[model samples]
Target: MKLNSAQLGKHLQGKLAAVYAVSGDDPLLCQEAADTIRSSARSQGFSERQVFHCDASFDWSLLYEAGASLSLFAEQRLIELRIPGGKPGDKGSSALIDYLARPAEDTLLLISLPKLDGSAQKTKWAKALIDNADAVFVQIWPVETAQLPHWISQRLAQTGLSASQDAVELIADRVEGNLLAAAQEIEKIKLLADGTPIDADYVLACVADSARFDVFGLIEACLNGDAVHALRMLDGLRGEGVEPLFLCAMLARELRLLSGLALQISQGTTPDRAFAAARPPVWDKRKPPLHKALQRHSAGRFNHFLLELQQVDAQVKGQAAGDPWSSLARLCLQLAGQRLLLEA
Candidate 1:
C-alpha cells in the first residue's frame, strides 16, 4: 500500500511489511523513513543487516543471493538496497520482479531510491513493487515554501523546545527548501536552547544561514532578473567556500539550456512547447524563470555567455590570467540584465 512519511510510523506500529520501498528526492525524509524501518526491524528480531548499493557495475544476482542465503548471525535479516539513480536496467527489473514474486521468509527488504517520475512509475518492475500486497510504498515529498514554517515548528516541538512564531518563521526563511539543513539547524537550536523557549532573537543570533543555496538557485535568480539577490547569494556561497570551477560549470550548464530552448523557440516553437521538450525536463517551478531568461536573451547571446564561461573555467584552473570570481560576478550581472564593463 502507498503511504506518506507521516503515516509510516502508525503503519509500522501494527505490522511490518515484507518489502518497504521508500522513495523521495528529499534526503532527510528518506533517511528518516529508512531509519524508522531499521529500528522497527531490529525490535522485531531482525539482527543481521546487509546493504547493497546499486551502481553501474552492480551484480544483480547478489541481491538474489543475499535473499536466498541463510544468515550466519541471526534468524531474521534486513537487506537494504539503494538505487541512487532510481533506474534498474532490464536485468534488474526482471530480477526484482522474480524476487518479489515470493520474498524469502524471515527477511525484510528495504529499498531506497530517488524520486521516480511518471514514466518510471509505469515500468513493469515498479508496478510489481507498488502493486504487491506484501510491500509498503512510501513516497516523501519536499516541503513547499508555504509549509516549511509549520514543518520547522513541528520539528522544534519534537526536540522538546517550543519556538515562537517569529522564531519559526526566521528558521524557515534561513532554510527554505532544504530540509536536511533545517533538521541540522533544529539540532543546533536544541543544543543552544538550554530548555528555554526559542525566540526570534535567539534564532537570529545562533542560527547561521544554512539555507539551501546552490548553483541552481543562482541560475534561477539570474534568470528572474533579480541581480541583487543573485549577487548576494553568490557572495554567500563564495564565503561558504564553494569552488569557482563548480560555479562556472553550473553557469555553463544553464547557458547551454537557455541556448537550446532559445534555438527551439527561434525555430517556430512556442516557449511552453520548447520547455517541455528540453532535456532533463525543466520543472514547473522553474519554467517561469527559464521562460523569462529565454525572452531576455537570444540564442546568440547565450552562446556568447557560454564562451565567457569557458574563459572563467580556464581562470578557475589557473591557466588564464584573470579573476574568475570577478568574471563570474560580471556574467551574473549581465544575465540579470545589468550592463557591465567586463573584459574579454
Candidate 2:
C-alpha cells in the first residue's frame, strides 16, 4: 500500500512487507526512511545484506540470480537496489514486475529511487510495485520554503534546544531548502549553545551561510532576469573552484530543455503539459523558473544559444584560443536578457 514518510515508522511496527519502495528527492528524508527499514530488518533477523547499484551498464540477470540464490551467512537476507537515474528501461521493468509477482522467501527487497513524475507513476512496472499486496511504497517530499522556518524550529526542539524566532529564520535562510545542511546546522547550534536560548546574534556568529549555489539555481536567477545575482552566484561558484566545463554543460542542458519545451509550446501545447512531456521531465518546484525562461526566448533563440555554448565548450577544452570564463560570463548575461554579441 502507498504511505507517506510520516506514517512509515508506525507501519514498520507490525509485520514487515516483503518489498519496500522508497522514492523521493529529499535526500535526508529518503536516507532516514531507508535506515529505519534496515534497522527493523536487522532486528527481525535479516542478517545478510546485498547492495546493487543500478546504472546503464548494470546486469539485470544478476537481480534474478540474487533472488534465486540462498544466503550462506544468514537465514534472512535484504537486497538493496539503488537506481540513481530513476528510469529502469524495459528489461528492468519486466524484471521488477516479475520479482514483485513472487518475491523470494525469507528476503526483503528495497528499491530506492528519485521522485517519479506522474507519467512514471502510470508505468506498468511502477504500478505493479505500488499496487502489489506484498509491497509498501513511501514517497517523501521536500519541505516548502514557507514552512522551512517552522521545520527548523521543530528540529531544534528535538535536540533539546530552543531558538528565538529570528534565529530560526536566520538559520532557515542560510540553508535554503537543503535539509541535510539544516540538520547539520542544528547540531552545530546545539553544541555552541551553553544552557541559553539560541538568539539571532548566536546564529549569526556560529552558523556560516552554507547556502549552495547550484547550476539549477543559477538558471533560475537568469530566468528571473536577475543578472547581478546570477553573476554574483557565478563568481561564488567559480571562487569555490567549480569547473568551467561543468558549468558550460549544465547551462547547455538547461537551454536544451527550454528549447524542447518552447518548441512544444509553440506548437500549441500548454507549458504545463509540455513540461510533463519533456524527457527527464521538469520538476514541479522548478517549473515556474523554466516557464519564465521559455517566455524570455523563442525556440530559435535557444537554439542559437546552444550553438554559442559549443564555442564555450571548445574554448574550455583548449581547442579554441579564448578565455572560457569570460565567454561563460557573457553567456550568463545573455541568458539573463542582456543582448550581447557572441564572443569570437
Candidate 3:
C-alpha cells in the first residue's frame, strides 16, 4: 500500500511488512521514515539487517544474492538498499521485480531512493514495487512565503519546545526555508536550552554566528554591495564543509527567485506583492536579503547568475567535466568584478 511520511509511524506500529520503499527529496522526513521501518523491524526480531548502496558501478546480482541468501543465525532479516541516483539499470530493475514477485515471508526488505519523478514512477520497476511492497513516498512541499511563521512554530514544536513570534520570524530570516539546514539549527537549539522558553534572544545567540553559510548568504552579501564579505562568507561556507556544488545551487536558486520577482515587478507588481509571490526562505531574515536583492540587481544579471550555477551543477554531476571548485571560484570572482565577462 502507498503511504506518506505522516502515515508511516502508525503503519509501522503493527506487524512489520515483507518489503518497503521509502523515497523523497526531503532528507529529514525520508530518513525518519526509513529509521522507523528499520527500528520497528529490529524490535520485532528481525535482527539480521543487510545494507547496500547503489552506485554506477554497483552490480544488480548483489540484490539477487541478498534476497535469496539466508541468515547465518537462522533469524528474520532486513535488507536495505539506497539508490542515490535513482536509476538502477536493466539488470537491477529485473532483480528487484523478481524479488518482489514473491517477497520473503520472514525477511523485511527496505529500499531508500531519491525522489522519483513522474516518469520514473510510471516505469515497470516502480510499478512492480508499488504493486508489491508497502511503499512510502515523502515528497517535499514548497513552503508558501507568507506561511513561514506558522511553519517555524510547527518545526519548533517537534523538539518539545515553543518559540515566540519574534523568534520564529528571526529564525525564518536567518535560515530562509532550506529545511535540512533549518532542522539542524533546531537540533542545536534543543541541545542548548534548559527547559526554558526559547525566544528571539535565544535564536539570535544560537544562529547569528552559525559557521555554515548557504547560497542565500552569498547572494545577500552581493546584493548588499559587500563583495568582500560575500567572498568571506563563501570561504566560511567551504570551511563549514558545505559542498561547492551545493553552494552553487543556493546561488542559482537565489538568482532564479530574484529574476522572477524582477520580471513581475517590471510588469507592475508592488514589493509587498512581490514578497508574497516569492518562496519563503528557510529563515525569515531571508525576506530582507531577497528584498534588498530585488533593489540592487537587474533581472538580466540575476538570470545570468542562474545560468552560471546551472553550468556548475552540470560540471559537478560529471555531465560536463571540469574542476568544480575552480569553476565556482571563477564565478565568485566575476561577481566581485575580479574577472571580466561580457554581460548577457
Candidate 4:
C-alpha cells in the first residue's frame, strides 16, 4: 500500500508487508518512511538484514545472492537495496524486473531511492514494484503562501508543543515555507519553551541564527541594497561551512517571502501590516534588507528570481552537473543586483 509520511505512523500499526519501496524528494520524510519499514520488519522477526548500494557497475547477481541468503538465527531475513541515483538505468532495471517476477519468500525486500522523476515513475521497473510491494512516494512541493500558517501548526505539533495561531502565522511569515528551515526553528522552540506555549519572542530568538554573522547577514545586506556588506557576509558564510546549495535554499525562501509580500502590497496591503500578518514576524534586523528588496524588485522580477533559485537548488543536489557552489554564487550575485537571469 502507498502511504505518505504523515500516514506512516498509523498505517504501520498492524500491517506487515514483506516488500517495500520508498522514494521521495524530501530527505527527512523519505528517511522516516524507510526507517519505519525497517523497524517494522525487525519487530516482525526479521532478525537479519543485508544492505547494498546500487551504482553504475552494480551486479544483478548481488541482489539474487542477498535474496537467496538465509538468516543464521533461523528468522526471516530483510534485504535493503539503496539506489541513491533513483533510476538504475537499463541493466539494473532489467535485473529488478526479473527479480520482481518471482521474489524470494523467505527474505523480505526493501528498495530505497533518493527521489524518482516522473518518467522513472512510469517505467516498467517502478510499475512492477508498485504491483508487488508497498510503494511510497514523498513529494515535497512548496506550500502555498496563504496555507503556510496551518503548515507551521502541524509541524509544531510533531514536537508535542503547540503555538498560538497568531504565533504560528507569525513564525511562518518569518521563515516562509522552507520546511527544513522551519523545522529547525520549531525544534528550537521545543527546546526553549520549557512546557509553556511558544510565542513570537521564542521564535525570533532562534529562527535566524545564521543571520547574525554569515551568508544570511550578507543576504540581508543585499536586501537592504548594501552590496558591500552582502559580499562580505557571503564570504563569511562560505568560510563557515554552509554549503552553497543551503545558502541558495535560504535565499530562495527569503525572496519567495518577498515575492509573496510584494503581491500583497500590489493588492494594497501596507508593509507594516504585511509584516504583522506574517506567520512569523520578520526579524527587526531583517526588516531593513527585506524592505529594500521590496523597493528594488518588482513582483514579476522577484518571481523570476525565485524560480531561478529553485533550479539552482536542483543543480546543487546533483540533478545537473557543473560547480554548484560557483553556480549558486553567480545566482546570489545576480539577485543582489536589481534583476537576475530568468534562466541559467
TM-score list, all predictions = 0.86, 0.79, 0.63, 0.59
lDDT of 4 by residue, 1-344 (tens): 55656776676677666667877666655666788888988887888878989888888789877766666875688888889888788888888888787787767788887656566778998877766654444343345668778878988887798877768877776664556667777887778789765777766665674333466666766776766556666666667788777787688778778888888888999998888777787755467768877887778988887777777777877887677666666656666673435543
Q: Give the residue spans of candidate 2 off by over 4 A.
A: 225-232, 241-286, 296-344
2 or 4, greater by TM-score: 2
The residue-by-residue lDDT of candidate 2 on 1-344, one tens digit each, is 99998899999999999999899999999999999999999999998999999998889898999999989999999999999899888999999999999999999999999999898999999999999999999998889989999999999989999888999999988887889999999998888788866899989998977887777778788988889878877887888899998988898888888899999999999998998898877778788778777888999989988898899889988899898888888888888888765443
Compared with the true structure, what per-residue lDDT tens digits does model 1 show for residues 251-336?
88889989999999999999888888988877766898988888788999999999989999989888899998888998999899
Highest-scoring model, TM-score: 1
Query: Candidates' lDDT values, in order?
Result: 0.90, 0.90, 0.75, 0.72
lDDT score, candidate 4, position 239: 74
Cα RMSD for predicted model 2: 4.7
lDDT of 2: 0.90
**C-alpha lDDT of residue 64 in model 1:** 86
- Range of the 10 consecutive residues with the lowest summed lDDT in candidate 1: 335-344
Ranking by TM-score: 1, 2, 3, 4
Model 3, residue 90: C-alpha shift (Å):
0.7
